[model samples]
Target chain A: MSAATPPSAVGPPAPGDAGVLVIDCVLVTEILTGFVREEVGKVGFRRGVVGLSGGVDSALTLAIACRALGAENVVPIVMPYRTSSPASERDARRVAAQLGADPLVIDISAQVDAYFERLPDADRARRGNKMARERMSILYDVSSARHALVIGTSNKTELLLGYSTIHGDSAYALNPIGDLYKTQVYALAGHLGLPEEVLAKAPSADLWEGQSDEEELGFSYALVDRLLFHMVDERRGRDELLRLGFDGGFVDQVARRVRDSQFKRRPPLIAKLSQRTIDRDFRYPRDWGR
Target chain B: MLSDPDVLAELAGEARPDPVVALAQGAPRLGDVPANVDRHLELIAQAAERGADLVVFPELSLTGYFLKDLVADSAVRLEGKEISALARASRAVDCVVGCILEGDDHRLHNAAVYLSRGEVVHVHRKVYLPTYGLFDEARYLAAGDRFRAFTMPLPSARAHREWRAGILICEDLWHPTSPAVLARDGVDVVICPSASPGRGVGSGAELGTAQSYDVMTRTYAQLLTTYVVYCNRVGYEDGVGFWGGSRVVGPDGEIRGEPASREEAMPLHRLERGALRRARIANPMLRDERHDVVDAEMRRLRRRSRM
Candidate 1:
């Protein structure tokens, strides 16, 4: 009430919006930036490591961490396989150059081949998961050597559709763009002045040659986001979408994917017949240390 | 047709005068003893002297809202020395200002204590404490369960005119039950003492808007066909801020008086409750209740539950 008193909404970085993806990037960045500053203040950390996938999500995340933790505090890892595209390697370099950080290239083709040889006749999915975990193992070891936290790059779409390899690319100490959808990742990457090549490319895990997310997932990220907006945000039913001029088959397909992938969206479910479980069985977040 | 200057002069006399209520955005008090209350009390009385019958102050007028842990000590009981001072001060121009009421139960409550004709008529505590983001009111204050309205005898020695008034505190206005109960009791006017926080969530519900608060107040007013007076506190407290924006609406939900937010200013408005009786009589929102649709289902549920 006095002249000396300050007003609210002071120094707020960005206001939120109704579209979750548009505002989620800011929210995630704010949380991660805050986390890094607070964690760094509490203890000493040598640097931050990011798995640079030459994709918009990782590029945006890497850029954010580079800004928050400084170029010297950040180390970008580019782990390409022998079958991996040259463009992917070049895109990773472009991201590193724009981010003003050096990239550490670790070709995992020989390692992956040796891994399959040791256990022959392994399924492609199993081998892919192993590859993802192998990359995370390398990142963790390098993080320990550098005394840094592993910054994650998987965006909301990858997390939502279960497109990410568990403990592989999904493994990180903190994620700055995990809440943003894949489409929003490009938007934010543009906002942060990231390289055009990284933002415009078709997103790929690049575990093997000639693999694209659309081909594997049976739908584009744009269509997934649109269907998600209708079902999740608008809370519309399948019949309602059909009545609104949507193809019934496509609506049903997206709805099924949304329902099926919900498990990956949440923490691994634990049977809760006991007193305590891995889930929010107890009010630990609220009553912790109280 | 009554002007404010004419009303104040008549009320300024020692003898009993016509009835009036002054509404204002009582700014925040960052300390235990409110500095703003003392600073604005003189000016408020001057405004009251002009024609204000009863002065309505915002929620936590003496001490600011979001006082957090300070509510324990900052909240004074109606019988305390601080309220006694306010009661005595109300006698100067024969006007009442809102104050927090701490009861004997030892639970602090957000309340509005009214002083009229050198006496306390009624003290109404808030019935709701919004526990959503940035609000932990249930942690400090207890919710009041009673619904109350009082008749203030007029000053004229021979006149039979008496104003029946009802009171609600803060979040009480948000719920339909609070105002519905009061209006059902045939209250001439409903006075809401509120301390709404500033806009933070960026949802459809925009705080500090005339329409946002007005929708709730006027909806009840139109339903009951009674005058609604809303008084809100202004200024920042900790991280949550208050946007004053006090207003008075008629039975038809028309704005009679609108006060600016973020300032300590008084705007006196007049209402004749008798004029709304016909409006209520013609299209009664109260009388058309489908008891069979509501009560029957509730009774069925109760019988099935064996409660």
Candidate 2:
């Protein structure tokens, strides 16, 4: 490399001398679906299944999979809990209708209640996690029974914050929206021209009645994302942030959420006393040993 | 990939075209940051005034990198009221420093503000994050997944001279996908803002730090057939010493200009635009791309047991 002068010396071209490099995200996504299609063919599999909850993320996932693998290749599972809203069920069926995928309406309320009856000492978080795990178990079982891989529905935002239930919603053979933010998801949904009902509804896990994502987090995705942007993207300091015109209370809150969620972002910690740990000591890609 | 000989012959044959580059280097830290960002900006502005077309800064140029707690406080909403000062500055000097952009996505990103023709043209976020080592990027950032490209005024203010440029945050340049994507999309030059750590690398060590990085740069510049202006940060931050050895490697595996290692000096390089067109004509890697090779996900799935 030349060492005499840095490249920052060059001046920008005058007005009208620059060419724009716009990314057609929609087209890229279509290309992604094409890749998924080719992947399914390469695997010699014609069928796939999706656990659709009528949420925008899942609906979009199911829709994309349907386009890539076809309606016959995709399955939509709506496993409603006791508190699952009717709107959620309707949304799931609506998405299935739009995508032409058959809907499997399996109300797991009774089964979840049975488990709770056996173990009355379970806490809310535990119960919620159990519900999530139960959904995954059903999806995987159907996957095995149908000889198909379960397509993951979690988006990038959930992945970053560890907002997903591990071994439950997070376990998947493949994921499409793993790189997009919640905000970007909305944009993509618009590009896909999805049903307005799914796009307009407030985001929710539908684990419990009226449980919204923003309410539980005690902050909006907008504010949390901004705070995260400052901390994560810009690599700014906490004190300098206050000088930049953000509320101290909000900054501290977002920082705490990001800090507390670190455990979720990593592989489960194994005591280093043992020689071999999963990600750290025994490092390999997912396909290793196979 | 085209051989170096093939690239050099083509570049040598092309008419000597004036070089224009848009730079993106390390920016100032928010609070308690070393006084290099402002000083560097001043140096870059002066260099630009001396007929340099574009002067780029690193991600978060006005602030330090990885200010985890300081983002909310130091974040600048590019479209909001905070960018007024930057807009004014860009208009005054006709240069854009890659600014720490507080995006309306409600996310703070290590973004580059392309100030050209007296306006902020576009902003690019750092796509790849270095989560390992002393970096805890995943803790604070939402990774950028899109490969949106931007066109800026060629660093030469010459009328009728247009150039396509792309901005990649530090870690993004390390990955082949970034340059590949940009080059395939038809960018003339790729600017990288690197905050690489400086250290005493043992001579002849297994990982031989000195020779390794320049090799990486040469390989990429030649492979992509695009001008590469790598502006690395100098000095240290939080025990990490930045080795400032910024350089511009031509598309044909030769150095046009190299800055002193870890020096707080702003040296300028003159690049010939004709060199790029000539290099591309000789070895058109962009025209010969097979996107099938870019998939890490599908490969992982296939390698796993089908059972």
Candidate 3:
């Protein structure tokens, strides 16, 4: 390799240019598949239970899990709320059939509605949170019953922006695509030959009838993924972000979201009283023995 | 198996041919030293069956890389039973094994032990403890202070050639001065054992970590005019996966065999003395190295920094 001019000498890419966000799909696929296989196998589980929402993130995650732990070894569970789009369920089933893995459909409307009957005035956010947690509880229950680990499907954009419920869809035994951005998730999904409907549809939480992620966030995933890549991954500061042609308000807004949602990314903090605290100074790897 | 007496007689009789080195790229169970020792013994025996004269394992092969607080729990003293077991296994073939070494001063270190002829031939603790970005080695372990080269006996048909060998554990090779010191010490081969995690998967078939290692090892081999044997581990430890791309780079900076990635593999390659001699003769970079100038400049810079 020849010594080239430093990147600092060459200015950063203009905003909306997401060329740096593009990944080598083949190599990323190998790494994620190997990660799933080793992490799941190390914990002594031969099967994985994924909460497939028919969104690109979950669909891509399930596909990778099936590739890692064979389609026969994966149990893709689709738990749809009553307000969720019917297209989601159809797309999820299509993906499962395409991967040759039989998926179990569990309608969560009964439990969600039964609990909400007492509080008729509950808002959309409350209902969405309840539905997400309800799905999480069901997935864990099935994970126990089937003796499989629950694979997470939250993408990096959702995780960094704290766009996910804390103990809801954010919880899993292992996540293969949490580090990937939303754009990268769709890229990998395209490379894996997922259902065209799943890949082409707008991303959504589907908690209510017309819930769209981009509409709620008020910006495109393509734009934010590029902005976040420069801000977080490359460690560019506020001035440097503006120098890179990012809007001042947009950069501050995304930075604030990342900071505010930091609590959602970590475990509940424990107050220290002893000489060695659990997460402080008394740290051990999660995979200590196995 | 050859008896001790038979092996001695063979060694005394005639020099053997080129030495075959095996890279035992196996995943170690976390905090399980005894089980890892058993696995090391099995790999050693298998390499012996394949007629390998030397077998090199990845960094911390006896204990998983992300030991964290388990460093104390899995650390092995030099006179401990784990090293003794590995020493006994070395009676069959020479082996380089990595572990958490509990020093006589009670300070633990990330170390590699070279065992030969049922004895602990040399131990090189990792000099640089990388403590940033997914590495917390300095927080848990002590760093080694020096780099030294030792005699490694390789059998040749012409005569008994005592090859000078040095062991630079993982991050030590990242620093130019470490390998330069060994090159100045007249080391013929640098055995690097690594537990490198795979990252930066953008626009390449290889992980960024693997690509960086390839560049560094090949550059070191060509510049120093010495063989570079790299053995990196595979498997996951707490979600971080170590990429296994163990390889041998000749003095001419050419890769000899195919490297396995993200999986357990044992690749053995022959180290040709003729190739080493030819590269050194053609390059002659090591012959005219100005060490005195470097020493003078370093002293001057140290004084200037203090001022």
Candidate 4:
């Protein structure tokens, strides 16, 4: 190769638990940024918006979005609940500030508390669902106000685990980081020059006071990344995973979650009452250019 | 596992020559010969910096695709300025470019010229002009009557090796013999420069034009036991969207690297010539092909089916 490999202008390799699926981050980022620009431009859209959750996934998406649509065009709205960590908000603010993005900070505490006040019998699960929906509601309102399409921040590992709220956090017009695994998100976050604090912090949904993602999922992102990379992408069967030093119980659990939550990854299935079913025959893209 | 340099040298000599080839997947404006030629030179230098031994562009890339009456203005003679600049750029890397070449008979042919070693080496004009559907090539440009492989210099880090290769314009490789004839001539590499547009709604089974091309190019590689360097342009020119799915497939009939998208890109791929030798030795399909019998039968059928 000429020029002594060009000084790795593509960036260094991000560490991963699974040796498989080590992406070419430079090429991937370029192609993905180009994709976002092309798809958005095809529909005559010059602006975009994303819900900034202070998590690595959203941080990575925002970075790519900023590159694609420019910081001025990308509106990162941070909607924090009362119980949401101060560090998370600080990180989100830092991300917006670093990108020169004027973020809209809308606290959803009053909205969530008001809804919970009426449903006094609502448990933590019910409250969490409501909070997720409330945040989305604010995001949509902001999107309308700014004439921007909402970008999603759900990761592939989380989607597989059904860790996100349906019709709330899962709803989006377009998503860039959804294809990456949770661990891959961290790697890309590092490459994109996200704050060290954001990368170092334990990932959480921030629905409660101290709810870490690993605790809820009963496995680490590194472990799940390795398992899912082999299971989903590599198409490794149960025996193969076991042969590759994976516990049988862990494999069974991950496999069951991925299989059961397949519905969350797709649109609502409509019955084929007509020739062009809503989710079938009449299905199309976002109509960027017909 | 002895560390013998002589054994390593012998093995390396037999290994595949994985030379880098860059695909210039940018759209050229209609009849913009000078600018397009300049762009080609820039891409050639960039490809050379990226270690590319050869760089290819789309069909009639000097002009735009879907040329109606603009080909006359776009056509250039062999000694034209555009060819001369490209020939100078060839000092950095080999160049295969599609153009409307002005023929000796004073006609314009949809042509692909092979430029290497600061000279215009060979020109393979388009053998087939698609007149149906969206294409109207037969109405304006002269069709190439010949199809043959030429010996071109294959640049390597150590030394230059002579390689038998062929070039097929957009619609030429659709026919079976376009690739078979080259394989019969023992060509190792065949470059296909296309301006195919993206079409159809992506379904569960396919991705429209990309999927259709995948089957065709991969089948050609496997059948001929040869490497197929397929470079298709991206970006819309006059409402027609070109799906940039440029790829370099080895004799194993698989994509060697990530393909380009619907963007103006110059994706570099290192194609291994060793894969051809490996595939041929493994299948022996080319060795076992009875070209004489097939040729004789085709002639007999042609002679008998006369009106």
Considering every candidate listed, which one attains the maximal lDDT?
Answer: 3
- Going through the candidates in order, what fraction of the true interface contacts does each contain? 0.00, 0.00, 0.91, 0.00
Which run of 10 residues does model 3 chain B get worst, by summed lDDT?
B153-162
Give the Cα error of residue A83 in candidate 1, in Å.
2.1
Off by over 4 Å in 1: A1-47, A143-147, A278-280, A286-290, B1-307
Docking class of 3: medium
In the range A144-201, model 2's lDDT, one tens digit per residue, is 8888778888876677677888788998777777655676567667778778999999
All candidates: DockQ: 0.03, 0.01, 0.79, 0.02
Tens digits of per-residue lDDT for model 4 on A125-192? 88888888887888788778888888888988888889899988998777777778887788778878
Every candidate's CA RMSD: 13.2, 23.8, 5.2, 14.1
Q: Give the runs in model 3 whose Cα sits over 4 Å from its true position.
A: A1-18, B1-16, B154-159
Q: Output the number of the DockQ-best candidate.
A: 3
Q: Which wins on DockQ, candidate 2 or candidate 3?
A: 3
Error of 3 at B176 (Å): 0.6
Best by TM-score: 3
CA error at residue B142 for candidate 1, angstroms: 11
Residue-wise lDDT of candidate 4 within B11-60, one digit each (tens)?
66855445678899987766678877878888888888988888999887
Estimated TM-score for each candidate: 0.52, 0.47, 0.94, 0.58
In model 2, state the lDDT of residue A201.
Answer: 94
